[model samples]
Target: MNFVEELRWRGMLHDIMPGTEEELNKHMTSGYIGFDPTADSLHVGHLTQIMTLIHFQRAGHKPVALVGGATGMVGDPSGKSAERNLLSEDVLNHNVKCLEDQLKKFLDFNSGPNSAEMVNNYDWFKNFTFLDFIRDVGKHLTVNYMMAKDSVKKRLEGETGMSFTEFSYQLVQGYDFYYLWKEKNCQVQMGGSDQWGNIVTGTELIRRKAAGNAFAITTQLIKKADGTKFGKTESGAVWLDPAKTSPYKFYQFWLNTTDSDAKSWIRIFTLKSQAEIEELEKEHDLAPHLRILQKALAEEITVRTHSFDALQTALKTSDFLFGNGSLEFLNSLSKEDVLEVFEGLPQFTISKDEFSAGINATDLLAEKTTVFPSKGEARKMISGGGVSINKEKIADPALILNTENLINGKFLVAQKGKKNYFLIMAE
Candidate 1:
């Protein structure tokens, strides 16, 4: 399939300019997607655009990943109720570098003709003065045309009136497209559905200013089956950076997708053939409990974003936490690994001096931690075979836990029931 057809089948194509597919089919055109550098790390929400650029390159086209260093300073007002607090130059520069690094992971930079290229709008905008920008680039679009955009119109209707800095964002972004088109021979701009206005502005500018044609293609903005936002959990956005969101948690985010969402997401997120997805759906329907679709989706994305080794560790950690994984696995891991395995579990801390002298298990579970409300409950649970320490059933409430019981000399794994896990730390 060609680039446009591939996106169409994947349910990614939302809007396309009049001659986009024809233009794409005619030649190996250079296309670009702009990524806003609002944060140091791009989250899972950015994956669709990344996938778009990847698909573009896979179809034998040059894909340029543009980090919006200058446009980011004037935040895109799309889908916003009020103006965002602008980032300082130092912070914006840092965020730009971080986003560029993350963008590098998705596209090939070493291939012959279609290798991906990275650019920052700041590179071009830094030398151009305010006067130069308004005179050369800003004159192409009218104030009435800019105001017609839904992003601007909505803000104009709302109580938080728009700022000149933000209102001028589309013009700045339009100039980016013109700059890339004039300098890089970039003929197409791709983005999410929300960017339709800004993208068309670019195409419009290209036509009026440079008297050249440009294409615009936008993909569907991702949302959940329930109509809530995608890429968000109770904790926050599912970040691509392992430090921000661990591979295990990242894997879990997709692994826990609803069946309906999984069917759609598996296609949009993964480069899996349609046949493979259809087959997986068949298996999933046969035994919904198996969650084959979710697993496949999670594994592919996790491995691509993180690594095979990271995915393996995430799987091992998941198995140990949720499956009938052996305690030996936990024993073999270091304290750091153990903590990662039990991350977000309820934890209690005690001074090492107190832990040096043996403490009664009941006292430790009750007074020292919130694992149990009182000593009586701890005693009863221990007698009832419902309590365990390091996967070993606690047979005696009188048993004393010392430094010897501490895994890696600083941690203890406590269980109140089969699934309720707590971590005790001695520092």
Candidate 2:
């Protein structure tokens, strides 16, 4: 597979230094992309770079994933309006380990000749003294050259102004490339287009310091068709970690994408072939309401980011909440999973003793919980066959709900109509 051609067809290629494609075509070259350990978990915003590395490895080249432990402490000023709060060494260490674990899920580290490798910038920077860094790296790049970077110039123009720590981040990042080139024979650096300046600085460092040739390639920064940020929702960023963002929510995030974004994102995020994607697009066009494209994108990405079982659970969860799915699925869930399934719904707690003794359906929905505004409304809804408990219709307003109705021995799922849901917890 041609690496540059793959990126280009997927609309991922943004900028490529001269001869980058020619160099890649000549032989299996090693390249690296730096990931900052600012968070314990990588969000969907980082998927572009992750996909880049995946493609790099798929093209039979060595892919080096550089986790920025030392540089993370200084914080990159690129695309930032203010200086970030620096994390402690311990926190940065934890984040780096977490990132490594996540990256392993997508890249093969055991393949011979062109396997992926993980590196920490701190491994080299930890022993190098500040004086040594200044003399060896700092002296190579002039202040004018560093200041010429868009990342630096924008910060200098910002209201808060840039800090010295952030100001020197390009130099630190540039040195990372130099060290990798010298030690690991990594020839190329890849990242989002915003990092073009930092990446060029690295190539320039290799030239000035060792007279070595290096290359740079950057992918497009993804954004929504509406011009808002990608990977963000009403709740927050959709994270790769299931603990931070539930598999169900993660699935919904992709499944709910606009038709336009889904068409573009499927190419960039999934490993589906061009022919297969074109087929899916034809089917989607025939039935836009079916959201064929969105489902394909969501299913492929969710299973890759998580697991097949997780995708199944997310599908069942969606059905249970939105369609006529069974209670058996809910019964199989843990307490935490159950809560996650009903995460933004209204919830109310009732006494365990009261629930054991049994409460009238109208009373349960009205006085005990706010599923209804009043008993009259609850009775009205129940009489109209618009209320359900545990996926069963309430036949009579005076129907009794006891401990037997509890799902997983602690909760009741309530539905006001076809859509609105509520959680009744017995404690």
Candidate 3:
């Protein structure tokens, strides 16, 4: 269970300080990765760092999950092109607590010797005065040294000059490492490739301030094979919170990974052994149309991030929508669950009074709603056996629908062909 080797084999290793591997191998060293509370819920982009910590702990080392309550206020400028709007204390506190709860799900916090622990920088930085920080932290790094960082250098060259607050962000974050090192005996700091400069600053602070050695390692930043940003869809980031991004959508996000991206992500995201992944890849190659790789990746991740039950529901919903299962499955689901399953599909609303009176199927699809452009077109599709309501084929153009036809008494699931889906909501 060599941590460095594990990351290397998975193509996750990006930057490692000299002797980092030796330090990790020598003993059960304590290591940590910091997460900022920039949002109430973490997105898929944070999964890599979460996986890094998981691997660190799996290798029989103490893993610490640090929440950047203090640094979050200042905001890390690592990959940002411009300044960000600051969050208030109440909002930031809420976000920190939310993120802490999410991180706890990925690691074993109860195991004895090498158990995971959560720490908040705000706990210490809350009472520290600016003057004290300048004397203790700012004194360790020179302005020239700080300005040399790529994050700082880039901001200086841009029209919107970097602010003093952002410039000192690295120093604030470095102190967090120093504090953890001095207090928790955390030996190594890990993060995404973009945080290399900030991480090194911490190690340097340890050496120059206390003549102590600290190690750094960074994993590759996840990106799409198409060169677009990872973890983002047209709606925005794919959030970890089921409330923000439903389990179905979250599952679909990974299920939709491109073949090339799946080849790489399967290694980084899943804890499957090399032999197991290789076997899956071989099977996937045999039938690319089956999307075995995408399915494996999605199932593993969805189960871990959400739950086995969630994965089952996502699968059942997928099966029903894709035409592999019957409408009875939809009928078996609760009204809320049914709506969740068809979240992204087209939906139309009709007055409850109009719906109770029972409308003609053709009128419902053509006039009352827009499932088809015209009554004639709707009739033709119905005749061709290409249309369905509540999972049953529309038998006649004049067939009536009303409250009795509504699943859970509020909705009707309409299907056009095998793929196109529409939801008719009666309120």
Go through the candidates in order and give each one's C-alpha lDDT.
0.93, 0.94, 0.93
Kindly report which residue stretches of model 2 are placed more than 4 angstroms away from their true locations once superposed. Answer: none
Candidate 2: global Cα-lDDT?
A: 0.94
Tens digits of per-residue lDDT for model 3 on 50-141? 99999999999999999989988998999999999889999999999999999988999999999999999999999999999999988889
Candidate 3 wrong stretches, greater than 4 Å? none
| Model 1 error, position 191 (Å) | 0.4
- Candidate 1 lDDT score relative to the true structure: 0.93
The worst-scoring run of ten residues by lDDT in candidate 1 lies at 320-329
Rate residue 44 of model 1 by lDDT.
98
Candidate 1 residue-wise lDDT, 1-427, digit = tens: 9999999999999999999999999989999999989999999999999999999999999999999899989999999998888999999999999999898888999999889999999999999999998999888899999999999999999999899999999999999999999999999999999999999999999999978999999999999999999999999999998888889999999999999999999999999998999999999999999999999999999999999998998998788777777677777778777777777779888998888998999999999888999999999999999998987889799999999998778888898888899989899
Clashing pairs in 3: none
Clashing pairs in 1: none
Global Cα lDDT for candidate 3: 0.93
